[model samples]
Target: MPAITHEAEPAKLRLAVIGSGNMARRFLKQLPDSRRCVLRAIGDRDPGQARVLADEVGHLCEGDLICGTEDEVLTSDEVDAVYIATVHTTHAQLAMRAIAAGKHVLCEKPLTVNHVEAMAVVDAAQHAGVRLVEAIMFRFHPQMAAVRELVRSGAVGEVRHIDAGFAFYVPSDPKAATIVTPDLIIPDAGGLEGRLFDPHLAGGGILDVGCYPVSMVRAVAGAAAGVDFLEPVSLTADGSLSGDGVDEWAIAQLTFGNGVTASVRTGVRMVDNNTVQIVGSRGTIELLDPWALSPSPRVVVRRVGHEPEERAFPAPGAYALQMDAFAESVDGPEPEQVSNADSLGNAATLDRWRAAIGVRYPFERDDAVIPTVSALPLRVPAAAPGGDRAGTGRIEGLDKPLSRIVMGCDHQPDLLTASALFDHYVSLGGNVFETAHFYLDGQAERQLGRWIAARGIRDDVVVIGKGGHAPDCTPEAVSRQLVESLERQGTDHLDIYLLHRDNEDIPAGEFVDVLNQHADAGLVRVFGGSNWSVRRVAEADAWARANGKRGFSMLSNYFGLAEPDDLPWPGCLDVCDAESMRWLTERQLPLFAWSARSRNFFERADPADLSDEVLVRCFYGPENFERKRRAEKLARDHGVSPSAIAMAYVLHQPFPTFALYGPKRLDESRAAFRAVEIDLSPEQVAWLRGDQS
Candidate 1:
């Protein structure tokens, strides 16, 4: 590791404490002793509490310390950074606000309530160029450093297994219990009543105390493998939830890619051994007090055929070390601190642990659509007028204009994340959402439906519903699934519908007849086929035209800049080849291209990295690499990402085209939306596909 050098008289980082709770008080107590940072302000929901905290640390400031509400402190120029010691539910919101205000942040762990929020927060911080660190103070402790060194030095050769636990009994008292309901879990309220038992506040033992053992396991495993962190390949958990649905106790077993295994236990209402043990082939290492180091932290190493060795290291308060490290990291991140990736991995593990035990917060439930942290609609520039039909296209038999890019609704993990993504997409003028019956076993349709109902934008948006998937690809199944899809979506009629897969075993006219029946009954407006070959579609349309019924007007197939070398899933079709493109162009049928960017083929810069099996199987070949090369060149010329260039290629086809984009992050959606602004000439499109025109 390289040494971090500082100037002889380094400037002290002006810091503000965002919450005036017990954690904030502890941080303030350590602020006075930190040489690299100084207390500048204290903020809380209650001004009186903020003033109390400010008074205790006011003497350490060179000037008058500001004490006010959290918003005032965030906007104040006196503070350069903020330490968010608020409750679990408020962490993501406050961190986002702080990042938006352009202030460095040291957020308490686990970074947010779940991985979805953590990804958003981390991405925002990176995009804003603001330093953000999860305050897992133990990472900055000297004892952890010693442990990492020992693991890396072969003291515990080839680490094989790890056992860790962090639990303590917190007896339930009637007097200390606040109203155990979702409606009353207030944010930033300094009280100990039902704070740790309320699901709305993201209260539970796994998130509060379980993170310690999980993070330790990751760090120790990373040291053994010579990396910053190693995420578990698979994990299974068992636990008990409180009456309010918060986890009271849990145990998770994890297996890493490098053959390292671990078992971690945590709880707030149960007592267990609070230590970490790393077992290796040659020896074992144990920490007496891993999370909160004792005055003299000890590391016991027991080697094969040798006496047990005991080592002690001087222990400065972990919070003090964390504060100093965060101050230094304003310029650049410290090597020993908990990194953003580390925090994301830890949050994902906790999410899985909670999920395995069926512990879900109220906000994540199906009935609720948690608003964004700001609780204000995002402000985005409207689509440019008269450019590519104002970044939208008209579909036959559909009243609403569909955005050139359609949002795919399969990857969202929960309602909160789905709502946020939908909200952002709408703010960017995107109205079309693509949902299938098989996605997440119908959860996707339910989430999209709930979001539409919550926003009351059912009339303003065009929904694309798909049914008749494989193993149930019959007219009877289509009729049954359409009714369920409508109910799940909370709508009376679908703007557009498609058969998820073709069934050659049955005549194409039978499927067309079923869809037309739904159309006659006011359950469907526009009907089409997904993954159906040209012959099947032509036959279906012929039958519909002869019988005086509605027929296929659009298609959902794998079409993108790069020609797919193979299909990623069974019964999928590709229409990017010359013959299929010509056929579609001749018919002038609208194509809703799925896997539109070749499933991130253009986004990944390295051609040698084959870690993604789908990408390799579908898009890894000489022809696709050449296409990717051209996309990069064009992307540089247009001052956009290769992904944007690929999306533009899809939209620039001779026939009407709309790209189905499934973005797991906000930035990715933004990038896909930008493709509509890019205009590619005919020659450029031809050249991009290696055609000499």
Candidate 2:
């Protein structure tokens, strides 16, 4: 650890307190009066309470204080440091916001509710070059520093085990009672009344008070090893819960990498004096009260066959020491006494402890654990998905039926949002999920994997995985990306795999052979090409037939009523012209068409308003305008949307075809489903295309 530089005399640092509850007031009372720090602002959810806090603290400090909302104080330039004493769940978010705005942060203990979010905040602070310190003030006490020094000096030689516990009983008061009802029970208040027992707000003895013992043990183990922190190899925890299903008392055991073991016990519903004992092979060191700011420091050092030596030290204010350290860290060569890495490690250990005790918050329950069999996911079930004749289609060499209207997942954000959309689609008899390797930075595939594992509905759906896109389109790239996509989706095989882009430079025969290799390994059920010309398909089939391998089973090209005047994106191929339709009709091959509605050119487009760049470059021209106009008249006559009419044009093509649909919400999905019910005769389709009068 690098030493923090201290100035001989420095100006006071401006501070903004983000919460006005009891903890905030306690911190304010303990702030040093040496003019090294000043309380400049108070921000809280309640303006009245914030103003009261501001008035009280303003006289104690050297600044004129004002009250404001969280946003005002966070974005204000007058604040040099932010002390976050908000609820447990809000610590990470507020700290990240302050770090982004170039302000130092002192977040209250249990730096975050969990490890995943804590890592995100720590990463953001490191990137922005800001100091992010956790306010576990007791660690900064002079008594603790003396104990660490004694342990480092080999006073307790070859430390083998540690026993530490912090416990206190919170009596039940009438004001903190739970409101009873027939179907639900609500808490009476927020601060100490309900927030301390609520799981959703991340309140519990484990997160609130047990964290002290956990961090202390970790530091003791590190001190024994001549480091600042040590990660435990395994952790086991058990707890007794309160009426609200949160832990009121808990005990945890951690084993370090160096074979040192430690036990930690904590509670808010029991009575015990907080103490720490470091037991070594030759001697032991004991601290009577270790986790309080006002406890008289009593230390006992005992060696085998020797009388114990008792020592006493003066008590100091922990919160004042913390505040003074934070003030010095504002222009740091290093941040305060606690490093960000130590905070991260502590949060991760607490997260594991919470998991072992089966304690979870509302926001962290989105993902369901996948069941393990020999450390592998279960095989996909064999039930065929529910489908209708008009909404489902079939391809050669594959047994599972696919939905005619495929679900495109290019912009899904997270598992929770994606799960809702997936549930709606399945309810509407949709079964296929179309995604690629690069969608949403590979999150789409990961979310789909978790959703399927959670619902156990893998056999009831068909997953379309695409790879080998553009510049790296080769046999090796295709194989590598297919395996990676399979791993991301948590499946052994893909129902349908398509090449996202075609490489004309590579021989068509080489593409077919590589695809056959995947099929032979049972990794791919059916393989096809996207954006490839009909001539290339024929050439690939000719080579496959000669070599006795599986040929391309489908063609997923752009086919819609409103033809593309020019390519909407570079290196994209559309087979919407007359010759491709004639070839498909003659061969009767399965056609899985993309952008089948002409990118919604008919629904949101008017011939009088062609101002959109995509509309002008892709689907706005004299012929497409005439086609959209005719589709509009047909849609009005048939009581459907113009987009549905365009969909009818693609579905009622010369051969077997399927249209891909991208719906952001449930209503949009329903509109797309309504289009599946509209059937158009060949004559009506030709009339809409302006082929006949």
Candidate 3:
């Protein structure tokens, strides 16, 4: 037992409530105000309410009392963090304001009503250099995490849908006269429905109450994305408005990036209770009042892997635990809190659906655009001794930030050769594959088909294919190429599809529509543009927006070292330069480099002998001679091959681009994968760019 050493006292959190609402009251009453936490002050509109709250537990928060305004509370001499439990409309503004005031804010649920406004709030909070949280206390429950664990653990094979509802009528203390009644005088008589119906204030049956499903969607979606909770590709929602024209009830269907979707039904004026059922490929997880309590009501798992099971953890005040965690975070350097932006994005999904359904709020100026809020995020990541540095390594738990190695496949005729290359690449952590119908005059697809079928590695590879290699990027070509590519690779569908070349004359929308149609049919999961110019990329993206089609996710092109005489290929060189690379980085588009090693452009038939191209280049071409000589020296310094230096040069680009390796041998593959782990410093890149430094 190691002599039963005494443990040190845990760190305590300091908290200040910015509102004296019922929820705030509940939080204050339940949570302890001792070492783990202490109330600095309470702010509310009514002095009576604040004083009552301050006096409710005199013994607990002995030194603290109530304040009049948010400013008074935030600027107080004694405080560590603040929690906002005020009106929904005030949520975004107040949270940003608090963050700006240099205080950590845990605003009550529903970060905001719209995506843009929500993003603004996040940006603002970031700018303020303080913590901001959208309080969805239910998410803190272990049962929800338990559900995620079950889904991820493969207990529910691949989850395709989540169906949930949180509904209960708020009659309020034996259901007397409404809040509008003059007898008692309750301000903001609009209540939840006021902001819930206001498109400006972020209202709707969904916005009013759709967070349950939208939040669940975030929990399930594969990417760091704010998925459209209604569209199947992303979301296309419809709502049922109440007598006030706000979303009293709503129905939404959201599709995940991976083709998984959820059917959501949520409302506030419901006649009954709430329930959630997560339907996966294996089975379903059903819970009654899942958002209700810890030990969290009861979780019933009907999974395919095992017989149906029911589990209940000994959850005692899970919400308190969440508050404690947030408080502790504020008390420390970095808080374990998800930002208000995440929560706001989710609520905006509901708001969008409500807007589409004509649910309007008081301040909402336009039904199309959700009301915008000013936002600025302020948290600066921990600095190194020398401050910020480029090509920096990993930031822990980056919310699905970036993939390291870009996977490439050679469209070679010999299926075994490419397959062997792919298998070796996989062994080395490469999964992003690139292929084309016209590769090797279409024989490469057949080879990949046989190879993938033999390896049964379809799930492991993110297969990318091209269809417009032929004259017309027609619907027929799209269909034929997709089917043929699938057949060749022995896959049901490619992970991504690219327009091999842009038919400048063809309306980009038509191509997007064709891709969308195929995508709808599940032939191509993600369709992108290859050899597309910035203008064409913009055009295609616009078309996708106009036609409600999926936009491009990747850009593939021939972009690497040139021998001065190095010529440009159609559409291939559009994004080849440093400026274009910077643009791609800003767009967050994943760039897939073709001919990364530039072997075919310059390398000799034999490693020992420099071919005529290499010989002619080194002796006659001024730029080529300098490039070779510089590469030789750098390779010597790094103890890597000159060819490895070339590969690293391409890999060195900032925006998460991967090299399309066309290695002719296993040794080449060995060298290429080895390059993924080697990150060149800015100095190294500059030296290579100078080529003769």
Candidate 4:
């Protein structure tokens, strides 16, 4: 879609300011000079404050200005765009609501409290097709544009290093008191008792001011290299924390992939030089005040032998320019000053900085609360196909029907990311989640547990827990890890449990006995093995039958369209061979197939690229490549992606099969879900697998 363009005469962009704080006041003051936009409303939690601010700026509006609570302004049809000048923690939530209402948003920096929240908001905006930009006003300043031009013009000659700092001291007051809650922080006293000193509000110098220097470094370095932005390859940081656990001061050294390095320093408890200096092979450029650009905006350039040259850029205030850019974006593309990727990357860097200093907000560690875009809990979509159920298969000992495509939770790093994907999966009628005790050292289990708790859908969803991985593959380790995994998952029992890997040195009967005990105790409903051989599985089941214990009912080995020539991991097994397939068909045991799409083998177009070492080492062969080619041909015939064909091949097996799919993004999960809608005949599946091609 074309960007929104508001000319002087025909149409004016209508905007609403959604906070009554100092930042909101500053933005309101810029309306008299803004040409492309008109003030439509003023909103705040306090209606009196909103009315006061609205009256103060009423003359700038060409129409009747609405004044009410933030929620009212967000839902008002009079507002075309919203300026979110609220506290740091509320940025993501407010932006989400604005996007939900189909309003353009210019949110304050740092975009959200953390990278996870930032990603959620960005994804929401993109999905909604609405404009969303972080309110980093300085980027739209004319002085910064001149700096970028100077760097891009080669005046600096191969930029190699940068040093930037933004810091100031705010005196602590003894009389100030703050009430900290899970979602917000209320201050009894003004200024000193405000959000700046509260951990619940994500208060810190790094997020508040450090973002300026980090963003400047990225912008300047990218201009020198002719790109929009460059991410750092490595970052090392050190900082001090206050009594309330916010960063007092910090310094980080970032190394970029383009051989450029930078040092960024920020603080709220101390004062620093508050300048930016860029060093290149032949010269250096300096900014007296890069962020505020007060007094006079100037840049100083000094070469090896020439005298220092100073240039000045005078224009409208930074806030005015930022507002103009936001208006332009309503019908246009996002401003390059603070694009979606830039905002997400900046948030990620800030997250790393905080992680380095051992600074984590209380909400971040709370497992029972998942930060979501909407206020209501996520539930399965009511209008889904098949009336709230998709294709599913049942195992003998398990009561709940497991979705054909099981969600693998190891790839999600945080609760927000996990919940976003998990919510989408459930919306598509998927109910089973695959988790393991050793994934991320149990972090994945905790995150999944948090998602389940927050959504209050433990009964609606099925959990699969795997334990006793190699090196700890013992009956005793299985029992011990099961207890810990249950606690981490916040569940009394896992619906389906599996041994991650086999320990063939021990008797198969010993492992079966431990599993049966857990099943009897209700800690596990049904038990299986992940990478055990077919012979060992039969041996364990034989022993279970003899002892009148519950036998193994399922297997979770690698099964897909393209057979693997070698194992990716030490003890991982591929059960696509004829012997294993025949055994599974005869025994009628359900198989949970991991790497069902051959770990993205069918998605790779170039068979000769050989860039991915693991893919090359495990799945590279003439037969596998032939299978991939045939899958692509079948996909074209069916008008679907080659990956869809690969997935269909696994689901079309004679035995009950559930494909364990690990997707890192929402779109990937949606695409995986589409595989269930495809149908393939047994002849077509065999042909794609090279059985009769």
lDDT per residue as tens, model 2, 1-693: 999998777888888999998789888987764346788888887767889888777787565676788768888888888999999888877886788689888899989886655655665576577877889987888777777787788887888998988766554673554533222333433346467777778877888888899989898888888888798999998988876667888899999987789999887675665789999888999987677645466789998888998877675467877887877876874543578778878988987888888877666665644222111233332334543344777788877777788888875565645765676577667888988886776789998888787778888888888898888798889999999999999999998898888888999999999999999999999888887889999999999999998888888888888888786776678877889888989988888778777778887777677668887788878888889889889889878888888877888887998888776555556667777788888899889888897
TM-score computed on alpha carbons, candidate 4: 0.86
Model 4 residue pairs with clashes: 3-331, 3-332, 4-331, 4-332
Error (Å) of candidate 2 at residue 196 is 1.3
For each candidate in the order shown, give its overall lDDT on alpha carbons.
Answer: 0.86, 0.79, 0.62, 0.85
Cα lDDT tens digits, model 3, 1-693, are: 568778998755456787776678777765762346667688776756777777775556746465567667777657667888776777766776677667777777766645544555565565566766667777766776676677667676777777766644434343332433112233333354344445555544465456766776666554212222222356666656656576656677777666677777776555334677877777887876566563447788886658888887656565576676676665454332344535655755665566566765544431122212422221223334654222232212121222234445554324424544555455455556677887777676766665555555556456668877647566667777788777766677777788888787788887888788888887877777877877788788887888676787777776655433443343444466666777787886776777666654334423355545643442335555456566667777877776677777777776766667666554566566556556678777766667335
> Cα deviation in Å at residue 239, candidate 1?
3.1
Measured over all alpha carbons after superposition, the RMSD of each candidate to the real structure, in angstroms, is 5.6, 20.5, 19.1, 5.6
Scored against the true structure, residue 332 in model 3 reaches a CA lDDT of: 57
TM-score of each: 0.86, 0.57, 0.52, 0.86
Candidate 2: lDDT of 626?
Answer: 89
Instruction: Write down the lDDT that model 3 would get.
Output: 0.62
Angstrom error of the Cα, residue 587, model 3: value is 31
